[model samples]
Target chain A: MSAFNESFRFGIRNIRKRPYRSFCLVLAAVIGSYALFVGLALKASLNNGIGRMQERMGADLMIVPESSEIEARNILLTGEPEFFYMDVAVATAAAEIEGVECATSQFYFTSLSSDCCSTRVQLIAFDPDTDFVIGPWIDERVTSDVSNGSVIIGSEVTPLSNGKVKFYGNEYSVAGKLGETATGLDHSVFMSRDTMHGILNDAKDKGYQFLNPEDDGAWVSTVLLRVSDDADITAVEKEIYNRAGGIRFIETDKLISDVAVKLGSVENIINVTLTVLLVFSFLTMILFFSVIFHERKKEFAVLRILGTSSRRICFFSLTEGITIGAAGGIIGLVLGILTVFPFNHYIENSLDVPYLMPSVAAVILYGMIGVLVTTLFGSLSSFLSTLSLAHAETYYTMRTGE
Target chain B: MAFLEAQKLVKEYNRRGKTFRAVDDIDFTIEPGDFVMIEGESGSGKTTFLNLLTGLTDPTSGAVIIDGRSLKETGDKEISKIRNQKIKYIPQGESLLSALTVRENILFPFTIGGLERPSEERLLEVSDKLGITDLLDEYPSDLSGGEMRRATIARAVINKPSLIIADEPTGSLDSANTFKVMEIFRDIASEGTAVIVVTHQKETLGYATRVLEMDQGSLKEVV
Candidate 1:
């Protein structure tokens, strides 16, 4: 057999001979690699969620009724279905404010969980002429404008076999489907004001009135505003609060920065934890291998007397380390996948933040990196102990016989 | 020419800031087919002299030459290669690796030296000569003391080294096994390989062509 094969066989036999020691080393690597995989996957998922949120919320400032501010934020972040209305005049006044580049209004409605709808979901109606937020998204998916009798579905919503969805005794044709935004928006449906009005009239015919008795259909839930490029966001926010009275102004940048701060705290915790785990694993491996080599000093001395070079002894030691590390790392990654992916929704809910898993390719890359680092640490730890043992005086070591 | 030579060899040790000699200025030579035995009292440095001869320890002030090259001028890797290829040192007690079978332990020298494995017939022949052919597949733990000793001797000769240096090879064996091991060494030396045995057992002197004694860190020939 080849030299490498011989060395490898010898190393494997040694590992089998000392199963308890090898297990301890492998356990160290497993803990380190598991932490690495889970921590990196979570960090990437939160960052992806934040990026998606920033991109999807195209409005610079959103003006909602003061009482519905928290509700609106929850709807945007969590996709919880809610409905509130203010005067349609809020959109007109906000549009007339200085530094306001454009203004559009969205009407919010929640469908009942009964048979009249496919599922309980948020229905958001946008004004086609002035919309800047949902319009671009619609244009990307559909070949033409969404007609009055058609609706655009979010990624999570399921349409019927006929490509239609029912709400409050009315069925609308499905126009197109939007990609995942990893926010409450993924569970929302988008339509034109005309389609929304038709739904409301149909609801009213069933004696379910969503708007105030005096308002008829002249109501809007929130007005989305895009400020001019050179305008200060804070200034625009104040102007909107002043011009559109009895409203709460939500600055998109502030909202994003707040989430980013939360994300930073989570990342710091993960970094500190990963650092602690890796350091602990590395030191434990060094200590274990040191003790193990010391106990086997006689064995090494015998090899030396049998004409084995110190370098070859070291190589054999490292091969054993690599085998232990690789086995542990692969097992840890498999466990990480099982723990992180299957409970991703639970993790997001418990954290109460935006959490979107990264792409498959990114996940695979992270796994590879984790295994490489684990193997490096394992081999490096063995090198320190083996170097001294390999170069020790063979006569003294054999005579001492630890 | 001498198959192995040591010139003006000296070995010293420092204990608690005081220096003492283990082997002092000992010059020795052995030719092919020579079975030389050195008898010494405990702590008389017979093992240290053997260590120096095998290049396992560097002399304090002199040199050991194997075949033609001086050990002092040999690099560590080259010395290891020489040890693997040309010399085999069988230390006292159980030296078989516990992790390998008797067969693997015997073949370890060839494997580590990157030499092609000896044919199965040669392996069986060596083991059969050492009376360990039946124990080839057993681990060291499963072998008795005498069986383990024979396995070590088998490993030492498997590489066909020019010289064999055994330190107290029968230190822990019964009389029957001890005489059996000594007869094997006598047979090996008769085939033109030089042999050196260090022992306190006077009975083993019967197999030696030349006998020496070590006393107070020095050697003197015995008639």
Candidate 2:
């Protein structure tokens, strides 16, 4: 056998000889690795979720009906279905305001939970000619235009086998499905204004009373506005409020900033917990190796007298540490997968924040990094103790042991 | 040429600014097949002299030359190889690793340097010579004192070194076991290997071809 192989075998034998000590070291590594894996996964999920939200809210500001500001925020942030309307003239007025680069109107309609629909979901209608927010998203997903007879479904929406979706007894061809945005939009359906009016007429024929006394097609639920890049956002908000009489403005940046603050708090907690766990595990390894060296001083002295080089002795000790670390790291990552993946939705809901798990390849990469880092640190801790013992006078060490 | 030579060796210790010599100007030599015994009182520095001979410690002045090469001039790796291949040291206590079987302990010297191990037949032969063939698979904790000593001797001689340096080999053994151990050393020396044994027992002198006594860091031949 090569010296390295013999050292590895000897290390394994030593670990087996002191089962309790090895167990303690392994436990320390496990706790540290588990914390690292779970913390990284949670942080990555939140960051990804926030990034998607920022991309989805392309509009700088949202103009909703008076007194429905909170409801509009809920719809945009969480994808909850809510409907309120203002005169469609507000879209024209907002577009005419100075510093307003683009303005578009959207109509919200919540479908009924009756047999007339496949599932109760939110229906969002955007004008294909004057749309800026949803137009680019639709263009990317659907090869053909979103015509009056077709609808684009969200990632969570299931279409019938015939590649069609039904709402209020009217069937529309499914053009495409949007990818996940980790928001209520994932459960919503998007369509052109003409298809939306057809759904409304079908709903009316099915005895639904969605029309108000003053109802006309000239009403829109919310007006999305994009301010010019060089324009001051506060000045534009003031100009919109001064120009519009019965509309509440929601700054998209403010919404994202609020979520960012919450994400920051969560990241802080995770980082602190990870730091504490790593420090505790590192200290435990150092202490464990110190005790092991003290107990094995004579053994090392004997090896030295038997023609084992000092470097070889240190390598033997380091091998034991690396073995314990790798074993613990793998076990910890397995436990992390079991804990995080099974309760993914629960964790997101409990945290009341957007969360998106990373891809399979990313998870595997992180696991490998965790094992490598743990093994490195484990060997480093053992090296500190082994270095001194290896260089000690063999006769003095043996005599002291006796 | 002498198989081993100690030339005016001196080892000193400094305590509270006072210098004490453990082995003072000790000149010694041993030829091949010499069964030598060194007897000394508790503080007479016999173990210190053995340490110098084995290159375990450097002498403050003078040198030990083995087979014409000075120990002081050799580097650690070369000295360690010499210790492994040419000389064997059996320390004064129970030195077997508790984690390994007696056979593994005997084979450890070869494994440590990645050297090709002796054949199983050779191992059995050594065990048979030491009367420890039945205890090859047993750990150090399970062996009696005499059995452990014999196992240690087997480990020492497994490489068939040219010289053996044993310190207090029978310090804790009974009269019968001590005689058995000394007779084994005598038989080993008769086969052309040099043997040096340091002890406080006068009974061991009968088995030595040359007996030396140490007092106050000086050695004198008694026979």
Candidate 3:
């Protein structure tokens, strides 16, 4: 065991003896590991982003005013609030359709330029009794109802220090805050039908002319639909289109699935690039060690003359490889994290896709796996490089004439 | 019985379908405290002979017996142990490990032998004897040829092995360093270890108790 200690010490000294050669070996590992980590991290974040986007969209089909498809998509995708209205009678017609599970109406309101609001916010109102999305989340986070004078805010919304917010010059209780969905929903707030109408009345009293659902023939902005389990969503969407003229049926599920397919192609390209880098770096490390061992043949021969076994010599090589791999792996992981965390917004915007970091558990598990695999590669490289010495005859090795 | 003996030891090699003897059937013996010098021309097989005797290479036929144990009968690991604990080989030119400092190189035998490191006092004694005490911290690249040769000798003797085999130990040294190294070997042999030196230097014969000549893969004692 002490012999092993001495050999390990000698292995470290060997690496220190040739700085440039050692650096080249370590850098090969670093580049491979860095590429792998960054690719995996981005893939994980994109996957998570896809999930959140799907959850934030929470509707099987959305009915919007005719010729407002682009405007509706822009509002949901970018959170740049817009109000385009269709008659409230659209909800009653959709709910009466066969295979329609339930239908809910929502009013879109923006407070960016309204003097009655304390700050800019996208305020969306749903019928508390008929809503499917946002209601359950509010129930889980807070016990109170989103009734006459209270509102549920998304994670990105800010309330006063005392948990109150002023909208339309009226003070409302901030009932709860939503969890992050990594989507535009995070920047929007929810209110019940009566509370939203009361805010609209206050704004109207202040001389605002936004459409009012209570006015006969006035329109609500959107009607969300939940299709029955037994019904094909496409069939129901077609039925809704036939029965309800002057409204566009947007299947939110199809939107998510389409974006998912496009993101998968980007992921494939990254995977291919990562595979090439891994192979190149792995081969480079093997070649580096092979040449180093060949150059050190005479040094190893001298050790054998001093009665050191070939096994010990091979062990020295293995130690050097593992050391280089571990050091390189740690450096690579840190670099990957630093590059991703601070510049994630840039990556997401460049790719025109949503991206969220993976959970802490996933990051740790993946990081460990990366380090372990690279270390094993390093060990295998050393083993292949030193196979000749492991089986060499001491006489021939010594006679090689160093 | 001799302290170390070779009974008709032979080593042969095949090259391009022809077999030739590197060390032909030869019998030799030396007692503890003996200082033996072997002189030969290039390719005369003096180095091969030393390799055979020390178990560095397997004999094609016949066998070597050290302290009554046949080297041919021992396993590879056992042979390595025998080599580590009983024999030390110092090869020609630049044998010191370049990565290790002089002191670490001298302590290397114990490391390979799996023995506890020798105390610094004993190490200083050996280094002082070889006049390398002041050069312990220096790496092999920093040492002169004579200093490296002396350091190699210190490494070989640090384990206090029963047999010391050196192949052209002073081949790269100046006359002053060569004479000084031979004197160190002479003193080591006086301490009761059998010392065998293979060299072409006629001046080295002065330190030997017995001198042998190698001609055509065979050994004959002259003095």
- After TM-score superposition, the amount by which residue A91's alpha carbon in candidate 3 deviates from its true location, in angstroms, is 1.9
The better candidate by lDDT, 2 or 3, is: 2
Residue B168 lDDT, candidate 2, scale 0-100: 90
For A1-402, candidate 2 gives per-residue lDDT tens digits of 876788789988889888999999988888878877888888888898889889988899999999899878767666667888888888888888888888899998878677888788889998887889888877777887687579999887898788888899988898899887876777799998778878888888888746542353689989998999999988877777787778888888888899899889999998999999988888898899889888888888787777776777789989988988888788888888888899987887777666778888878877787777678768888899799888888888888766
Chain B TM-score of candidate number 3: 0.94
- lDDT, candidates in the order shown: 0.87, 0.85, 0.81
DockQ for each of the predicted structures, in order? 0.75, 0.64, 0.58
Residue A248, candidate 1: Cα error in Å is: 0.7
For all predictions, the C-alpha RMSD in Å is 2.3, 3.2, 3.4
Tens digits of per-residue lDDT, candidate 3, A1-402, equal 676676678778999999999899888888777887888888998888888888767678999999888777766655556777888888888899899887888888866555567677778988877888767666768777778579888776888677887887888998788876666666678888778778888777777757753672356889999888898888887777787789998888777777678788989999999999889878998999989888777787777676666677778788888888877777777887788788976786666555678988888876776676677778789888987975677667766636
Backbone clashes in candidate 1 total 1
User: Residue A127, candidate 3: how far off, in angstroms?
Assistant: 2.2
| Model number with the top lDDT | 1
- List ranges where model 1 is wrong by over 4 Å: A112-116, A158-173, A201-209, A212-216
Give lDDT tens digits, candidate 3, residues B85-181: 8888888777888888999888877777778888999999889877889999999999888899899988888867788999999888888878877
